[model samples]
Structure formats: structure tokens, C-alpha cells
Target: MPRFALLLAAGLLACAAQAQATSFVMTTDALAGASVGVSESTSDLSSSFGDDKIVLAARDDAASFVASDGAIRGARLEAALRHIRERAPQLDADDRQLARAILVL
Candidate 1:
């Protein structure tokens, strides 16, 4: 009985670890139109949200959002750029620069 309990505990721990490593997905359409313009900062992206225009869909560990129609895409773009800066410091300077440029627009 003790052996069985130990095995069960191990199984439960493995399952929990697997669940924690799982990825999530999200989608939004607020920036659908301005997908072309770029913002210089995350604040710019956040301010573009008008009422319910910015819709966020979150799943597990991931989230997606769309900007409102005609809203400036710069601020939202900046956020993605900032995320790369925060999450991928190992990237080369050129890669970071490209990421920043992409985030702006």
C-alpha cells in the first residue's frame, strides 16, 4: 500500500508539471486596421483602446487582442517590442533593433 501511494504521488506530480508547461493562446482585433502603423511605446499602444474596441482573448498562458478600428497601432506594436526586450536578452543587438522597428510599425 505504501508503494502504491508513492507511485500515485509521483504520477500526480508529473501531471502537474506537464500542465504548468502548457502554452496558451489568445486573439484580439482592436488593431486590425492599424496593423500598418507603428507606435514608439507601450503606453501609446494602451491608450489606443477605446471602450470595447480592444478585445482580448486569453487562453491558459497566452493572450491575443485586436485594436479598435482606426486606432493608432503604435502603442500595441510597442508592447510586442517591449516583450522581446524583456524576454530575449540573448538576442544580438541587430536582432533587437529589428524587433524594435517591427514593434513600432
Candidate 2:
């Protein structure tokens, strides 16, 4: 029908106009400060703890402590938190966060 034909033609023209209105420009300006000279590996999760090696060392114990949800448990996690606070006092984290991080990392 003539009406359907007219609608199809208008839709096609609108789509074509939209396609032409869009433009893409590629540039290397963002990579100006990027340096691939030295890249650090992230495989070592213990490095995130810095000098607070106890946190990394007690990961297994922390995992066990986390498994026990009782209030009287979590001695290992507490010890790790104390070590982290003593060595790296600047870190802003709690036992729950440390437990999660220990499980994942």
C-alpha cells in the first residue's frame, strides 16, 4: 500500500541521517603519560599488606576464623588486624573487610 511504502521510506531516511550525523575521532592524547616501561605483577596479593606480613602470613588462620561465625572465635583475624594496625596504621579497614580480602586474595 502507498501508506506503508511512505512510512518505510521515511524510516530509512531517518536512520541514514542519524548514521551520517555520528562521527568518531581517534587520538593518542590520553596515552601521552602512559608508560609501559615497568609493569608490576598483581599475582602476589601479600604485597598489598606492605610490611604487615602477619596479615598475609595468617591468611590460612584467618580463613578458619572466618569459617567460625561464633562470637568467641576469630582470634586469628584479630591477631592479623592488630599486626596490620601496628605496622601500617594508615590503612582504614576492619576485621570483616580483612576476612573477605583474606578469603579472596
Candidate 3:
């Protein structure tokens, strides 16, 4: 009985950890739709395309946002810029502006 209780406690802990690690959401608009999530670490981007989701790890100074339906190409490009902004303060205003535009889209 003690062993069984230990197993049950371990299982519950695993389930709770899994839940805390993964987060996702769906968004839709008249023009397009997107589904986005953070990976198990919340440090990477997880994008779903139709039924498929891709996980992309980000740099230490970066944050990732996955768009609906696995539209990751654009999002990744934008993420790169954001990374620069967060990690490389030497970047000029022009660079920051460009990154902002990519993120806004």
C-alpha cells in the first residue's frame, strides 16, 4: 500500500509539471487565423499548422510567439530581431524600427 501511494504521488506530480510547462492559445481574424503556444520550458515557440505543431527554441535573451496554423517563418524572422533588441543594445534606431515592424505584422 505504501508503494502504491508513492506511485500515485509521483504520477500526480508529473501531471502537474506537464500542465505547468505547456501553454497555448488560438486566435482568428477575418483575414487569417493563428494558433500559438510556449514550449514545455516557456522559453521557446510552439506553432501549430493545421494538425502539426513545431517547436523552436529561442536564445537566452529572446522570447517566441507562435502564430496560428504553423505560420512560423514570419514569426521566427521577427523573433530574431527581438532577440537583437533584447540582447544587443548597440543596435541603432533603424534596426529597432525594423524589428518592431516585423513583430507588428
Candidate 4:
């Protein structure tokens, strides 16, 4: 019984050590990827939304729209969509996605 208990404890310690090592590696990799993603996403968002007149016009309104609690105010969204449809009708996007992109910009 004593020998069995000793082996079990040894096994548990080894597993715990392995878990800690694995978590450290995962955390390190996640941090590295997140840092790289931040810059890339910013640049991507800029290229996608920054140059657009309609999106630029809607940035402040979108910021305000998101700042408001639940119950979306669609006026700003509609206005932006209208402008997009009138000017660059080729671009396709849904309201939620456009709102998110506006927030990101």
C-alpha cells in the first residue's frame, strides 16, 4: 500500500509539472500572436474603412450608436448604408458587421 501511494503521488506531480509547462508555452504563444494581430488588424481596418467617405462620415455616429445601451438607433446605420449604396454600391456588408467595422475604425 505504501509503495502504491508513493507511485501515485509521483504520477500526480509529473502530471502537474507537465500541465504547468504546457500552459506556459500556450500563454507565451497566445501573447505573441495577440501582439502581432493588434497591429495587423489596425492596418487592415484602416485600409478597409479609413479611406471611405461614407464610412468616415459615419464614424462618429457609429461611435455614438454603439455607446448607447441596448435598443439600436437605426437612423445613423441607415444613413451610412444609404450613402454606401448610392456611392459604392458594389460593397456588400450587413448592418451588424458594418457597425462593428465602424467601431473598430
Candidate 5:
């Protein structure tokens, strides 16, 4: 009877522990293995909505975005590229292009 009571207490504790287990909303998606326009300072990239634009861009390339319907492409790309060059001073045109290729992949 003592062994049975001890087992019952242990089972209750286990159930309580399981019920109190902490959970988190984890969303840590790392970048591709290889990509062009590599932002090496992407340690804080996760959880940032800024990178979502890149994904959208990959889905809809510049070529597909035509001005036939009178919707002109913004100069944001050029500006963003310039900003990137400034931030990653070592990232040359070639590196940027390579990173871009990786991103598009």
C-alpha cells in the first residue's frame, strides 16, 4: 500500500510538472547556405520584417514588374543597394551580385 501511494504521488507530480512546462514561440529561420548580397551582420536578422521584402522580391523579380500598366518601379532598390554598400563597406559589386544570386536561389 505504501509503494502504491508513493507511485501515485510521483505520477501526480509528473503530471503537474508536465502541465507547468514552459513553451515559446520560436521562429529562428537562418538564411540559405549560399546567397548573393550576403548581409554578414544578419545576426539580428531573425524576427526582423525588413528581410520579408527580399523574399517578396524573389517571388516577383524586376523583369516581371513591367510599367505597361503604368506602375513604375521605385528607386528603392538602388537606394537600398547604396545603403548596403555603405553598411558593408567590404561588399563590392561582385559580392553584392553573388549574394543577390544566392538570395534569388
Candidate 6:
């Protein structure tokens, strides 16, 4: 038990050191929900995308939207990715993988 605790602490320390801007406990699910909670920095993603006019959808429709140019209120794919990365500065490459199939702003 003590060894497990030590390892967990070490892992947390590493994450903290990596993204010093803000901390978060993000979900690994395809579409992370709002209730579980995250660091204040990432917390905005859970709220802004839902609260604001931002629309989040699966990449299954992205190719078509990208082709349309003005589809979905002219919300370009690049804008969505930029929005997420900007608001959630702690996002990593792996998170990008999970986000590849989703558009969020």
C-alpha cells in the first residue's frame, strides 16, 4: 500500500511539473462529461462548449463540414482545435488523439 501511494504521488508530481499553467484530472472517455470535475483551467472546456454557442460533434461529420466552408455557422475545424488547446493549455498529444474525432470550441 505504501509503495502504491508513493508511486501515485510521484506520478502526480510529474504531471504537475509538466503543465505548470494549471492542473486537471481529465477523463479518458470519448466525450468527457461535466459533472466529474476538472482543474479550473480545463473546467472551462466542460462549460464553455456547452454554455456558449460552441458545438461539439464527432469527426464522422468533420470532413463534410470542412468541405462545406460555411456549414455549422462557419465554424472551421481549425478554430475548434485552437479553441480547445487555448482554453485547455494542459492538453497533451495523447489528448489530441482522443480529440481527433471530436470538434469542440
Best by lDDT: 4
**The 10-residue segment with the lowest total lDDT in model 6:** 93-102
> Which TM-score value belongs to model 6?
0.30
TM-scores for candidates 1 onward, in order: 0.26, 0.41, 0.24, 0.41, 0.28, 0.30
Report the backbone clash tally of model 4. 0
Of candidates 4 and 1, the better by lDDT: 4
Which residue pairs in candidate 5 have backbone atoms (N, alpha carbon, C) closer than 3 angstroms, thus clashing?
Answer: 35-99, 35-102, 36-98, 36-99, 36-100, 36-102, 37-99, 37-100
Query: 1-105, model 3: which lDDT tens digit per residue?
Result: 999999999999999887665532222342133111212111221111111111122322121222332233354545555654565454343432332323332
Better of 2 and 6 by TM-score: 2
Expressed as tens digits, the lDDT of each residue in 1-105 for candidate 2 is 999999999999999877665522112433332211111211222466644556666677766765765243355667876866676565555555555455555
Tens digit of per-residue lDDT, candidate 6, span 14-39: 98887764434333342365323333
Which tens-of-lDDT digit does each residue in 1-105 have in candidate 5? 999999999999998776665321121222342232344333222223245554334323322332223143335444444445555565444423423432343
lDDT of 4 by residue, 1-105 (tens): 999999999999999999999999999999888556445544555675577776777776766665674246566666875765565454455554455566676
How do the residues 9-64 of candidate 1 rate in per-residue lDDT, one tens digit apiece? 99999998776655221122445433333333323333432121211211111112
Model 2 / residue 65 / CA error / Å: 2.5
Task: Give the CA lDDT, 0 to 100, for residue 102 in model 5.
Answer: 27
Candidate 5 has its poorest 10 consecutive residues by lDDT at 22-31
After superposing candidate 3, which stretches have Cα over 4 Å from the reference?
24-105
* TM-score of model 1 (CA atoms): 0.26
TM-score of 4: 0.41
Runs in model 4 with CA error above 4 Å? 1-54, 64-70
